[model samples]
Target: MAAFEGAANPSEAIESGYYVHAPGKLLVDNISNRIALRPSSSHLLLGGIGSGKTTQLLVACQQINEIEDIHAIYVDVSRYTDISKITTGVLTAITGLELAKLIKDSQDKNVIESIKLIRNLAHGYTTEYDPYDDFYDDGGQYIAVKGIIPKKTEGYGISLQLVETVSKLAKATFENYGNLVLLFDGLDRLDDAKAFMQVVYSDAKSISSSGIGVVLIGSLTAIYGDYHDTVDKSLDYLCYQPFFDVENDPEAYNFFEEIIQTRSSEDFIEEAAIKALIRFSGGVLRDFITLTQASIEETYLSGEDKVQEQQVLKAVDSIGRNQLLGISDNELKIIKQILKTRIFIPRTDEDLRLLVRRVILEYRYPKLRYAVHPAIKPLIQQILD
Candidate 1:
């Protein structure tokens, strides 16, 4: 039950006793502390997919909101707009919408007008105008003046307008709430590193310049690929949330076990089954939950009351097979090389793709290491043999 629930909401996860502190660096505390010390500073939080970046960002937002004279806003970009088509204007518009909610009752007419403009832009409303008179032509025939043309705003013009609007919102938030810090989640879900960089390059500085603190969730490619230096220099701070080193560190292993024990009782799931789930999860929180949930289903379908090691393995294999689907032959070759050597040098776009897909899991503590996801390891080994 509890184990099957996703920790998408940080508050619920904490209150329900399902939240476990990540070992080593505390990402949530680190980001919140920086914002608390300097409310206008910008931070970039980068991690692999399924690395709990969203949960961490939400938690940081909550902590920052508790600080005196500072208001933290958590914006899930994916929920507000299509991540595949995300742009600077869309991001600024979404920020305006969220900030507008905070100051909806404000008497400032300028802020109110800006909020309306932002809502129109976010909702795809366009202004139409007639270029010619609609009077009758020769022979008293009614003229329709072709069609009503929607006024087009140039890309640069739109960018400048959005920047001005966001600046106004930032100032209004400061005047009313003391300081505004925005935690933007789901930008990391962008299709590629180039797209992510474009979003950040276009507006991160402009927003931060308005004395608004920003925390953006970014993908692994943003930190590991060619844009790494540019991204690093653009942000005031960078926090990389790596997968837990459960296999090599006893403390991390115990932390994950605590995560499971808090969610489910041993009477329903055996200790060995929990260990197998953690081991195959490769220390990724999402996979850990997925494997546990799948294992529970496996047990239930078998008419069993408790989940055993056998059921957990079956679940792992099922998930691994699903993961292997659509993987190209060339990609399989690359994976095989990494699996054999336990060394991954991300030299090309393919390597970055592997990293993003979690086909190759990167562990930071106890020295950086890369390996195939544990659930897929046995299958890879079989192929090697």
Candidate 2:
């Protein structure tokens, strides 16, 4: 049961012997070591969904927390706020919330006031001002007095206030805990590339200038086409976690095998079943875990003690069918073309969606290549034939 839990906490995964140390750890080490040397450095982690990005972020946080004179805070943005509505202000407020908790007992009046303001703003309460009071009645109409207009708490005002609040919190953290490094886990879920870029452009400088280290998980959109140049120039480093190249890398294949064997014994699942699960997983960790769990259920339903290749195949086919539920005929044609030719050149909105949905898997081993999800391969082949 524990073995097949797809998105286990990095610490829990490590403690329970479910964590696999492969090439992915290189990313964790790079971020951790850089933050240890310079606490104010900024880093961006780019990966697709189910690429173990959250796990990598948490592990790097754990490693950075161990370094002397450094403190790491892991913030799962999705856990605390709606990612669809995320903005620079919201991110600043949530980060302030975490910093406030770290220095809850601080007696600094400025820090305390900032904490109260952040709490109020996060709860949708803003400073009140009556614009109507500034208007004067002129016989037939209301006229605005030019010199006495009240300023509303929005736009530039809110941005300045939030920046000041985060600065104060960062100062307090340094005084109490030496240095602060924030590891953000959920910004990658933002579907709008422009919105994500806005956050990076608006807040990355402010946070770095305040002497706070940052490691943010970003979506693939940031690394594709036009957005890539801007993102590459904005951050101190950009680390990518691509799908494990199991087809060409023996070590990567062995890593998946160890992940499954750690959860269930060989006696419970046959070797061929494990191989089939790996092949159909498309080198994605989450898919591999899901397939393993489904195969276990298939065996249980059939009154069998050990999972066989047939059971694994049945589980994959069922999951594949579900994957195609909402796909349109046009999308099907696109997928069919990719499957038949085994080449994917991302050029349009539909291509990006397919990449995001994991219908198309990108691999960068001997050379960059794309392929259809192996679980759904047979069905597409049937349609073609």
TM-score of each: 0.90, 0.89
What's the true lDDT of residue 102 in model 1? Answer: 87
lDDT of 2: 0.79
Off by over 4 Å in 1: 6-12, 124-158
User: lDDT values of the candidates?
Assistant: 0.79, 0.79
TM-score between model 2 and native: 0.89
Clashing pairs in 1: none
Task: Please write out the lDDT profile of model 1 over residues 1-385, one tens digit for every residue.
Answer: 6546544455577667677777766899898888888999988998998888888987788789899999999887767656766655555666677787888888889989877766665564534444354542344323322111112322221356666776787778778899888888888878767767876875677777778888899888787778878887788898998988889989889988888878887668898888898999999988898888889889999999999999999999999989877778788899989877877898888888888889889988887999899999898778667
